[model samples]
Target chain A: MDISPDESIFLHIGPVALNATIVYTWITMAVILAISWLGTRKLTSESKMSRWQNLLEVLILGMKNQIRSISHQEPDKFLPFIGTLFLFIAVSIIMSIIPVYQPPTGSLSTTAALAICVFVAVPVYGIAKHGIIGYLKYYLKPTPFMLPFNVLGEISRTIALAVRLFGNVMSGSIIVAILLSIAPLFFPILMQALGLLTGLIQAYIFAILSVVYIASATRVHEEKEQKFEENRKGKE
Target chain B: MLINWFTVFAQIFNFLLLVFLLKHFLYGRIISAMNVREEKIASRLQEAEQKMMDAEHERDLYFQKNKENDERCAGLFASANLEAEAQKKELIENARRQVDEMKKRWNESLREERDVFLSNLRKRAEKQIYIILGKIFSDLSNTKLEQNIVETFLGKIKSLDHTERNHIKVILKESYNKAVISSTYEIPVEQQHIITAEIGDAVGETVEIRYINSQDHICGIEFKVKNYRIGWNVDDYVKFLEREVNKTLEEELAG
Candidate 1:
């Protein structure tokens, strides 16, 4: 049995190949896109709305609130990246309920790609707030001697983020597969149910962690701005 | 083996694309709609507050107007009451004056009516006395009323006192010795001579007696010399009776 959807190659064009990972990722993307289009095609600011619109609003507002609480700032900036991470992970994991469906999140490459996106986004947002010179200066905090360790810490945490998500999602699928072979009926269903819960929890954890990282990177600029305002007031 | 390089890159592209698409479709539209609804609610609240303020101002204005109207009404009512009181007093005074004028006119009319009654009484008394005396002379004495009248005139002249004789004498002298002897009827020659001789003896002068027939003597004789007069007539007796009657009536009214 393939442990990752990446192993199930569907086509090959010399060095390039199509696999279950890419195919299921496209499917997940398609599902997300279709639902988003349907929900927002006739968006209204009025009080009355369709159930689908309400559901979508609830979802988007919930993510924004979550991001706002973690970042302690406006959620609008971080919402797109963090919200996509949660929805993609959760939906990919939930799709595993269908027979013969391989969750794209169960693939190590997919999780790594998501983690790399978070890793890249942290500095991007930080640089957007404080400029590249100001953002890079955070690594040299406490002392220049600790800069290498801070850089290492950043690399290690990105690897941990990727590995942690992959391990959790892959282990759940593997356990359900092993249980299907051993008991096949009640235990596999129970494991699948447990997997659904863990899948949602993992998505939450991943989104929250990304927000924390991004917030940490951008928080220095906010502190500087606050201190500047205080100094200006003191002068006044 | 687990981490495919191509797939990882492909997934990264997919995730970024998804973010871009979701931002365009969902987050941007939803946030904008929420903001618009919030702004609309805020503006509506402001409008409602303004309307409430306007209503309160109108209420205050109405209250002020009502107060002014009440004051004006009270002032008008007080002035009207004063005017009405003044008019009432003036009406009462005019009524009293009219009543006094009417009372005075009534008294004047009563006095005029009393005068007319007294005059009529005097005339009637005179006529009645004359008629009664004529009847008494014819019934009792078997003599003419003219003879009795002439005898009475002669007797009055003969009984004159010394001072009354001197007065008649002076009057006769001033009258060119012409005396007018008027009677209600013509006297007989004998009675006339007796009257002339008695007057001449009393005065100690020959008076030129002019006998006049007149109705003014009231059935008696009147001897007049210019403004001076001496006579015996029913008029004297009637005047004395009228004076006594008037005195009695005054006493009765006083009582």
Candidate 2:
């Protein structure tokens, strides 16, 4: 059995191969976009809301609140990135229970791509808030000699993010496949349920970690500004 | 390694695309709708607060107006009470005044009526006394009484001063020496002749005498010589008694 969806390639064109992971990623994206369109097409601004709209609001608001609480910043600026990451991962994991579907998150490629986005977004947000020079100055904090370690830590944490999510999702699928070969029915269903749980957990972890990284980058500048304000007030 | 570099890049692009799509379709609409609902609630709350203030102001104004009305009503009621009391007093005073005036008028009318009644009774008594005196004088009237009256009158004429005797003579001469004798009753011819002779001797002139019976003399005799008159009778004594009685009654009323 293939360990990940990437191993199952249905088509090949030069170096660009259409694999199960890519196909499933597209399917997940399509389903998310379609549902988003349908859910938001008839939005009412009044206090009263339909059940489906209420559910969507609760989910969206919960995620935004979580992001805001962790980051100590406005959630709107990072909601699209953070929300997309969570939805894509969670949708992939939920769709895995279907017999005809393979989860895209079980692939190393998708996890690495999500991790890279977070990694790239961290620097972008930091640069946007503190400027490039101010953001780079954090690496030289405490001493200039700790720069390489801070850089390595950044790279290692990104790698850890990608590897951790990929490993958890792939192992769940692999364990379910092994369980299906031995007992085919009840155990596989149980393992799949457990896998769904693990998948949801992994999605949460990934979204939280990304929010932490973004917040870490921006928090230092915010603190500096706060301290400067306090010092100005003290002088006054 | 299950890593595919191309797939990784493709997935990154796909993830960015999904972020863009969801931001456009879902988060934006939801946030905007929530913001709109919040705005409506805030505006409604502000409107409610304004209305509450307006209601409170109106209530205060109404309370003030009610207080003023109550005060005005109380003032009006007090004034009305005072005016009513004053009017009642005035009415009582006027009634008392009218009653006093009526009493005064009634007393005056009663006094006037009593005075008139007393005056009428006194007049009747005087009339009765006059009738009794007339009857006594008539009973007492005789030739001797007349002769004594004539002699007393002649003595009074002899006692007269010369100027009065001359005035009587001049009056007698103006009337061609004619004189009239008036009496309430008929006198005897002899008495008349004697009165005339004594008057001539006293006056030193002989006067022609005419005798007239006059009931108004009330048993008195009057001798008229032109506008001059002289005589004596029982009527003089009766008149003196009547004057004494009227004077005594006047003294009693004064006392």
Candidate 2 lDDT tens digits, B1-255: 689888899999999999998898888988888888889999999999999999999999999999999999999999999999999999999999999999889877866775676666555655665577656656787535445555666677678788988999898888899888887667788888887887788789888889898866444678888778777665566567656766775576457
**What's each prediction's TM-score?**
0.70, 0.67
Calculate DockQ per candidate and list them: 0.70, 0.67
Model 2, span A1-236: residue lDDT tens: 88878889989998778999989999999998887776677789888887667777888999999999999899999898999899999999999999889899999999999999999999999999889998888888757999999999999999999999999999998898888889997989988999999999999999999999999999976687678779999999
The alpha-carbon RMSD values of the candidates against the true structure, listed in the order shown, are 6.2, 7.9
Superposition error at A114 for model 2 (Å): 0.2
lDDT of 1 at A202: 93
lDDT of 1 by residue, A1-236 (tens): 88999999999989899999999999999999888888878888787876777888899889999888888999999998999999999999889899778999999999999999999999999999989998887787757999999999988999999999999999999999998899978989999999999988998999899999999999966686678779999999
Residue ranges of candidate 2 with Cα displaced over 4 Å: A13-15, A224-236, B95-255
User: What are the per-residue Cα lDDT tens digits for candidate 1 across B1-255?
Assistant: 899999999999999999998888878887887778778878888889998899999999999999999999999999999999999999999999898889778766755676677668878888888998899888888888888888777778888899888888888888878898998888878877888888888899887898989987567899999888878889888889878877886576456
Off by over 4 Å in 1: A10-15, A93-101, A172-194, A221-236, B74-255
Model 2: TM-score for chain B? 0.49
TM-score of 2: 0.67
Model 1: lDDT of residue A226: 73
